[model samples]
Target chain A: MSSGETLPAAQAGTVESMDCLVTIAASSGGRRIEISGSGAARFRSAMENKIIQVLDSLGGPGDLSVTVQDNGALDIVLGARVEAAYLRFREAMLR
Target chain B: MRRTMLYLPGNNPNMLLRGHLFGSDGLIFDLEDAVSRSEKDSSRILVREVLRHSGFDGREVTVRINGLDTEYWRDDLAAVVPCRIHGIRVPKVDTPQTIRDLDDALSALESRASVPIGATKVFCLLETALGVWNAYDIATASPRVTAIIPGGEDLAADLRTSRSKEGTELEWIRRMMIVAARAAGVDALDTVFPSVTDEEGLRREALFTKQLGFDGKSVIHPAQIPIIHEIYDPTEAEVEKARKIVAAAREAAARGLGAVSVDGRMVDLPVVRRAEFTLERAGAMTEGGAR
Candidate 1:
């Protein structure tokens, strides 16, 4: 609830086939996103765009870190996971 | 038309995306028992997205939400009711009051989502002995109720027994369910046959329930869909007789006669209705035909 304080991390989804696990945490620096796993090689840029779009839609803060470990989940699943993880992170911040 | 409604885990994208291809009459994207507690939130999100983006190939789509007792039920309704699903299958429904409460919640969500109030149907899963006992009341509790299903494992446990291959445990419950569902003018859907590997057992159980007048059975495996449908579908002989009976009844009505006979058997209003139902089940009649 105060500046200089770091909110705990929150995550959603799993590493199962056709799924992805997304984790969000507070960052002191500018926005940071990490993508890996099955989809990263071919869909890295698109996945990044998707995460940014979802975060912007939710009004996510600039000082946040988003990490996605994919398992061949489609774009819809990725967006959903990111939104869920971000919402959970925001909830944790509120607490 | 819901001869088989397949259950797809809400969080499993593989199943969620391809479940309809298995050819069940309907799909039940499950957010309750199939999903873990920790993944509840993410599963809800995933199911919502799937509903929004994926195509179910014209299969009747429904979602099985957590019971009303859980904190997730309301959120579940909020997520799926707006997606324009065919219904929600509610578990642990023990009383008419439970249906009333669920009806209210559904109405609220439907209104908020701009869906017509009462547009979403309710499929009641009678999982407790008390729920089975109150089946008639629960079925008649709301207009939104489309089907009342007697549970397998849960109901057997509630009755302090285990499931038997012969279904000795659920015989009385199945009989009672049929009576109550008919009395309440709702469909009685049988619970899943757990022994998926036992094709013979599945056929036997499907035949039994079909004979008892169940509208359909919940299917856990894709392999079980055709088996249940095979049991529920009207046979060639049955369809032919039903067609003849229906034609005779229609001719009798046209001739201003109050009595009719088919194949030397007296065909009354009930018999005519049954014939028409047979034709309907055979897909010989168009939707809403000759009711």
Candidate 2:
């Protein structure tokens, strides 16, 4: 999915057992990522680092509101869900 | 030893969550035909996430990526190449070049991901008439390739034929693909049974394919697994015969003989090899090469 157009507010992933739900909302300011769940405090830095990696990978941080409803999903799972949400947001714009 | 390989749509969380409990020899997280075009990217993410967190519990796990002709496959490879998957199943493989190109890309990706070189395997799916003809080349294209699967519906359409309950349309294709797989020293998995509701039909097809010597069959529904396994797995008598053959072969080799007599029949290298493979599949062969 290409950038430049306004991203549609979209969400991906789930909050089901041991999974986290990540919702991506379009923003005009910049990428805002947050995580709240079990052990969220302990893994906040790691999760942020992963979210930053995802944003960099997509060349994003372009106007996005992030909400992570974590449920003990590992860093990789979190990253995948975030990337999916990001891609969903971008893809929604194309449609 | 892959009697049943189930295709679990990658985008469906319910499937991913429940797939491993079905007792299939492998679970193929499908990112190609199973996902809608709009959900492609999200599905890739879901697959990658599932790879990390799903409790596979020793079952073989693989991802079937979109055909290399698509724009989505690049991202598919990039996302899945580094994950702890047994292999990647590339669909619509019509040429050896496709395998070569994918292997090269995967090697590069593995390097970037700090993974062991050639850690991942590749399985090719022949979905086109051209792909069926080129199965040998595709199967032999890379050392990483472990199996070549022939797909129905698509293949039937490609061949300008219609699918039937009797499977006469697929007989020739299955035979040719098995020969190609044999020539390339890889397993050949028969196509799926489209009617998931037909347990009798599934059993018949599985038995027929097993008699044709396919190492496995693809399954879409969990209900079909046990029937496939029952058909493909060697019977108790066959396992016993295999064990005896292995023992006889071992005894013959110890005495400097190139052949062994088992049940008044001469067992040569080929027969002994078959026996050993049977024992291996039956899980009766020990680490010391004894059953």
Best-matching candidate per lDDT: 1
- Against the true structure, what is model 1's DockQ? 0.79
Cα TM-score of candidate 1: 0.94
If you superpose only chain B onto the true chain B, what TM-score does each candidate give? 0.96, 0.95
TM-score for each candidate, following the candidate numbering: 0.94, 0.82
Question: What would the per-residue lDDT of candidate 2 be over residues A19-81, giving only the tens digit for each residue?
Answer: 678888877578788789884889888888888888789877667788898877766667778
Q: Best by DockQ, which number?
A: 1
lDDT of 2 by residue, B139-247 (tens): 9999999999887898889888889999988888889988999999999988889998999999889988888889988899998888887777778899899889999
Q: Which ten residues in a row have the lowest lDDT in candidate 2 chain A?
A: A1-10
DockQ of each model vs. true complex: 0.79, 0.36
Candidate 2 residue A59 Cα shift, in angstroms, is 8.9
| Each prediction's number of clashing residue pairs | 0, 0
Give the least accurate 10-residue stretch of model 1 chain B, judged by summed lDDT. Answer: B282-291
Task: Please report how far candidate 2 places residue B126 from its true position, in Å.
Answer: 0.8
